[model samples]
Target chain A: MLEMSQVSYQVGEKWLLDSISLCIQPGEMLALLGQNGAGKSTLLKVLSGECRPASGAVTLSGQTLQTLSTNRLAKQRAVLPQKSRLNFPFKVLQVAMMGRSPYRGERYQASAEVVYDALKATGTAHLSERVFTTLSGGEQQRVHLARVLAQIWSPSEDNQARYLLLDEPTSALDLIHQHSVLEVARKFAREAHVGVLAILHDLNLAAYYADRVAILRNGKMLCQGEPFHVLTPATIYQAFGAIVKVMRHPERERSPLVVWTDQTESQSIKTGKRSVSQGINKSA
Target chain B: MLTSIQMHNSPGGTSCEAMREITATHRSENVDAASSVAHVVSSRRWSFGIGLFVLLVVVAVAALGVGAVSISPGEIISILVDSLGFPLAGPLDSAYQQIITSIRFPRVALAVLVGAGLAISGAAMQGLFRNPLADPALIGISSGAALAAVAVIVLGATLLSGYTAFWGIYALPVAAFLGGLVTTFLVYQFSNFNGRTSVSTMLLAGIAINALTIAVTGLLTYMANDEQLRTLTFWSMGSLGGASWDELRVAAPILLLSIVLIPLQASALNALLLGESEALHLGYNLERVKRGLIVLVALCVGVSVSFTGIIGFIGLITPHLLRLSIGPDHRFLLPFSALLGASLLLASDLLARTFVSPAELPIGIITSLVGGPFFLWLLLRQRRRGESW
Candidate 1:
């Protein structure tokens, strides 16, 4: 399990993240939702050990994250950056093999079995022999996903749950690959008991796949919990200022579907003082 | 119940497990073909490596045989064996043995070491920058070394003669090595901000330093006396004619150490190719690796330039040519470049001797003249084949 307590990251005078605390339990997927500059990526970076928080601390399995060596931290958590820029023409298999870099000379090596299994899991097995640079954007994204999977291939001693932190992983993918990637993440979480934190822009995808949802607005948490409880129309307006209607799935009632409404009554929600009066005026 | 999500079909209407099985089946079919392709590529690289080694030996033999006092390969071998403490029982003339042992052998050995050092440094620098055009000298390292060397030659007998007099033959290389180190440190400092080195900023700083050092070298050249001026010019163009047992004794250990340290950096260099943040995420301390690479390159280039003047393009083109066929796996590329570079320099020196017999051309001119065109052709081919760097 990964836990953060009262972490805040600041740049100059602006607080990018302000006193935020969150926990990722084993065998669960948490989706982080926010607008473009809402500190979701910054929070993810702090969680991945890429950025240091201004105050408070992060712990992995009850040990302080700062005390862990880089290799130890890497073995327990795998981060998939938004884009991977490889100047040389590395083969897909070689690129995947690099995921095993931290475990050099160890018994749990990054073997061909792990690499090929990751490729197959991501549905990128056919592109194993092709040059990575020659592949298209979506294909490259899948290849990188495979690389991170191969990094923390499985749980080790003491049954520690590995964590996967992904930043906009599906932004470059198409519809089919998007669902497939999330499916892979979900399967890995449930089967391997790995904790997953993914920053997603698509609300429907997050609603369908994420076990818990956290929404951020202006570097502070607006609401978080089960999707149905937290992702209400009022919460969506407070976070995104978009007047979206929360509806149940046609067949699966537990899941929520968000639909945008184009009406003046929604416009009243933006103007704070006259919202109640304007709602009554519109009805009349 | 969370596992129930895995049973949800994708947009393609296939469950995750079913998709995995399909992908596995497809990959199994292609595995043989892919493995065969991999086998062919590795074998091709292996043959290329062996071929280069063989070519180096053949050229070394030819180099030994083709000087002004042309000795046959058999005589060369006999002289070599006799020098190894077993006088080959025969009618070998002592003068032939003296010329080969005293003059030509040291020259060939120096060429091999210097060539290998420069080429390996270049390959590592290229990998560090992640740019195909980066050479070992791109950061003004050679210019700094050249400036110090020119200063020692012009001012050693006049202003600084009191101190440098004791240094004797070892003075120039030592000064050059210090110069290279100082300049690399300066460049590294100028480009680094908050613990990260910006490649573009570093490149721009290198240009500025190169300009300043060249201007200083020009001033030293203008101030030199006629004898000192001639020495300075000869040093600038570069040659293996200055090879000696003494200089080799000082240079060989440092060059060999650099050669050993550089190839060990193959994996780190490979990680660097993925960009700095990715490398950091992969658990590499970017600052340490970058600093280590710069110091190693500076050491090799400094020692080389001190002795051979400025041998251009061997460092740049040898790696490019080898990388074209071997791919960018530096574990193989670094060693292959060392052999290919050693042979290329040896061959160029041989041509410099025989091309205008009794009147030697500087090896630097030959390298640039040959390497410049070859580099252009490689770039042209890359463009024609539509491969964007």
Candidate 2:
């Protein structure tokens, strides 16, 4: 388990994270949702051990995060930041292979196999020979996801639990890729028993894929539980200052779909166009 | 949830073990296609590395033979071998041997050392800063070192006499090293904010620091005696004409240290291209790597500038060209940059000496004349291509 206990992070007078406590267990996916500046990224940074919280603690399994060696920590967890700035023209395979860096002295063939597997999982095997900079933004995001996947591809020999943290992993991806990327994460969580924590914006997607959902408002977690419980219309309104309606998914009984209630002029125009198309279909 | 085997059997499955098994069953065919792509890239890198090393040696040897009193290549090799305590199977000319061992050898050796040192340091800096334009000379490291060296030269006999007496010959390089280290640190600190480095800010910092150092160096020049003035002027323009065995003895080990140590961080540098946090997440102790790189760059650039003056653009141009050709894998880039840098400087020094016969132009002038235009061309190309920096 990767656990944060009452973690608080502050900068000057402002609190980036206010006594936030969360636990991610093996074989589960937790989706964190929040508006911009709601401290979702800060919480991820704190959990990844990139920054020290003002108070409280983060631990991996039974060990405190600060006490672990960098290599050990790296082996146990991989982080995919929201925006990756890789200016150099490294090939796709080369970028993905960097994920195997922590496993020093591992044979090239072994690492390559893992990298190839990761590329395949992310649907990027064909891009292995292409320069990473040439890839589309969506493709680049998937490549980075592949790199992170390759980092903790297999469980440790000692059966130690591993964790994967992602900040907006699907931000640059297309709709199909967005689902595919989340599916890859869900697959890893289920099959590999790796704990996965991802910051997501799409409530419906989170509800469909994540075992649990967490919503943050003003540096504090508003709610966290199974998607149906935490993604209620009230909590959504409180967190994002927007009115929404929550409905059960037609196919998946447990999943919920979030619908925006406060429609804008453009949305009304879109609705009018849809109604005109329906009338045309009826006449035909 | 589906079991691992069921997940693997699914059409949409991307399971690792199943993929591995499938790949293993067709391992020969699959591995060939994949490894062949990798093999071609690696093989090309190897060939380029070997080719650059050979070119360096050929250029060095050819350079040793092409000076004012031209010696034959055979004589140059025999003299070099004899000096290494391995006499070739022929009688060697005494005068040619003296010229090779004493004069041309030191000049050529210094050129190689300075070039490799500058180029590797430049490559490392470019990697460390994650900016393609980062260079020792461009970022004020060279001028900073030059300022310290000029101070020691102008004041050693008067204001800094006691200090000079204490350190003797070690004073200038030491001072220059400190200056370079401080300048690099300041520029780094100025450009870095909130864990991000702005390229424009870094370049602006470099420009500002360069202006300040040049102003101070000029002030020091104003107070120099005629003899000191002459030395300072030639030194500022940069030259390897004063190359002697003693100066090489002082500068070579430091230069060699930077050349040797920078490549070890090649993997870390490769990771760093992703970003600082990414490199750290990859398990590199980011602080240690940053500190080690800064010190090594300062040690080499400072020591090189102390001896060879402010040779520009070798660092900037060599790595850029090599990166364009061989890709940005620092494992290949660092060592290859050193080799190419050595060849470039040797070739440049050769031109400096022979271009006008008996009168010699400072090697710095030649490098700048070539490098300045190359820098502009690079800028124009980058702008045309719509690259960010």
Candidate 3:
């Protein structure tokens, strides 16, 4: 479990994360949803121990984050940043193998096996020999996902649950890959009992994959809970200033569908006729 | 929860033993494809390593044969064997023995040591900066040492006339080494802002610092008397003519210590290639690694410039040429560069010695003449490929 209590991060005079409190349990996927400049990445950094919070405490499993040594912290937590660019001509497998750097004591054969498994898990096995810089944006994103997966491929020595923090992992991915990547995370969480905290842009995707949803608006937590309880139309409007419909998915009943109502406005302008805008009126 | 065999649609791969074999084959094949030139270079790095060692020894021996008093290769071997407490099968002249053992050997050894030091330092700086163009001299290390050396040569007569006779031959190099270290520290400080050392900023700052140091060196040269001017010019051109057992005694320990310690950083450098944040994520202490690299490069390059003046381009070219032939795996790159660097310098020094018979050309002149064009070609090639490194 990763727990943050009244965690606030300030940059200069402005607060990026304002007294935010949250907990993520092992075997659970917690999706962090927010608009642009909503401190999603900053909060992810703080949780991953990349950035220090101004106040409050963060604990991974049972140990305080600040007290844990770097190598020990790395063995327990893996982070995939928003934008990672590699200019050198490293092979895809070599890039994946670097994820095992923290586990320097592990034998090379064992680590290589883990790297191969990670590549297979992310459906990037075919690109193992390809140069990393030659890959497409979506392919590179998946390769990095595989890298982080390989970072925490196995549990800790004491069998403590590990943490994986991903920032906008699917922003560059295609539709199939986006779903597959999230599915990989969900499966990893379920099987390995690892805690996952992902900052996502797609509301419906988050609802589908996440065990719980935490919504942030302007560095403040608007609401958080089971997707069904927190994703009502009124809450969506209050969080994102735009009106969106909260409906049940055709296949997954528990997951809510967040449909944008902006298309009707654009149609109204095109056709010189104003639609009733039922979703907006209902939210109001 | 499906195994790799099931995912890959292999019926026989259902067994763990078969899966392990498949993965091993997969990894080797990946390595082979990535280093497409692997076979043509050598079947194994060990063979390649042995080949380079043989090439260095041959070049070093060949260098011994081509000096002012030409000695046959057999005689050279005989002299080496006789010196090593073994009876020579062939008769070796006493004059030949004295020239080979005293004059050529120390010069050749110093050439090899300086070349290896500069090249390894360049490779390490390149990895640290993540830029192919990063050379220690390009970052004002050499020029800084040059400035200090020039200052000492011009001012030592009157300002330090008291201690000049006592320090004797040691003053110039000692001043140059201190100058190089101080300048490197200054450039490091200038580039680091708010605990982040920006490579682009460091490069630009290096350029400015180089310009400033060169201008100061020029001023010192202008202020020098006629004798001091000649000394400064000869020193700046860079030569192995000053190589003696005494100077080598001082420089060899520092160089050997640095060479032994640098290759240990291969894995850390490999991780750093991913980027600083990624290195940090991999549990590397970024500040410690960065600081350690700066100090190491400073020590290596400082000692080198102090001994041989400011030899340019060996550091930049050796690692890059080696990288293009071999892959960018620093484990092989660092050691191979050391061997290749030693060979290159010895060869260049031999040519510098014999190219104009008796009128010896400075080794720096030859290296710069070759390295400047090669550097330009590399830049154009990287531009054509649209790759930064």
- Cα lDDT for residue A124, model 3? 79
Q: Score the docking of each candidate (DockQ).
A: 0.35, 0.27, 0.26
Q: Where is the poorest 10-residue window by lDDT in model 3 chain B?
A: B12-21
List candidate 3 stretches off by more than 4 Å.
A263-284, B1-43, B87-91, B157-174, B192-197
Estimate the overall C-alpha local distance difference test score of candidate 2: 0.87
Model 3 Cα lDDT, one tens digit per residue, B1-389? 23533454344212223223323446665444434533433467768888999999999999999877889888998998999999867677999999998889899999999999899989998888777778888999998888877877888888866656777877776777777788788877887675455788888989999999988888888888888887787767888888888988888998888777888888788878877777788788777877787777778887888788788999999999987766677888888888998999998899888999789898889999999999999999998988774
lDDT of 2 by residue, A1-284 (tens): 99999999999899989999999999999999988899999999999989989999999987888898888888889999999988888999999989988987876776777787788778777788899988899889989988989899987677789999999999997666677788789888888899999999998889999999999888998899999888876677567655567898998889999997643322323123433334334323
Rank candidates by lDDT, best first: 2, 1, 3
Per-residue accuracy of model 3 over A102-185 as CA lDDT, tens digit each: 988676666766777777677776777788989998888888888898899888679878888999989998665677688788
| TM per prediction | 0.90, 0.93, 0.89
Against the unseen true structure, what C-alpha lDDT does each candidate score?
0.82, 0.87, 0.81
Q: Model 1, residue A263: what's the lDDT?
A: 46
Error of 2 at A271 (Å): 30
Q: What are the per-model C-alpha RMSD values against the true structure? A: 4.5, 6.2, 5.5
Docking outcome class, model 3: acceptable
Better of 2 and 3 by TM-score: 2
Best by TM-score: 2
Candidate 2 Cα outliers beyond 4 Å, as residue runs:
A263-284, B1-32
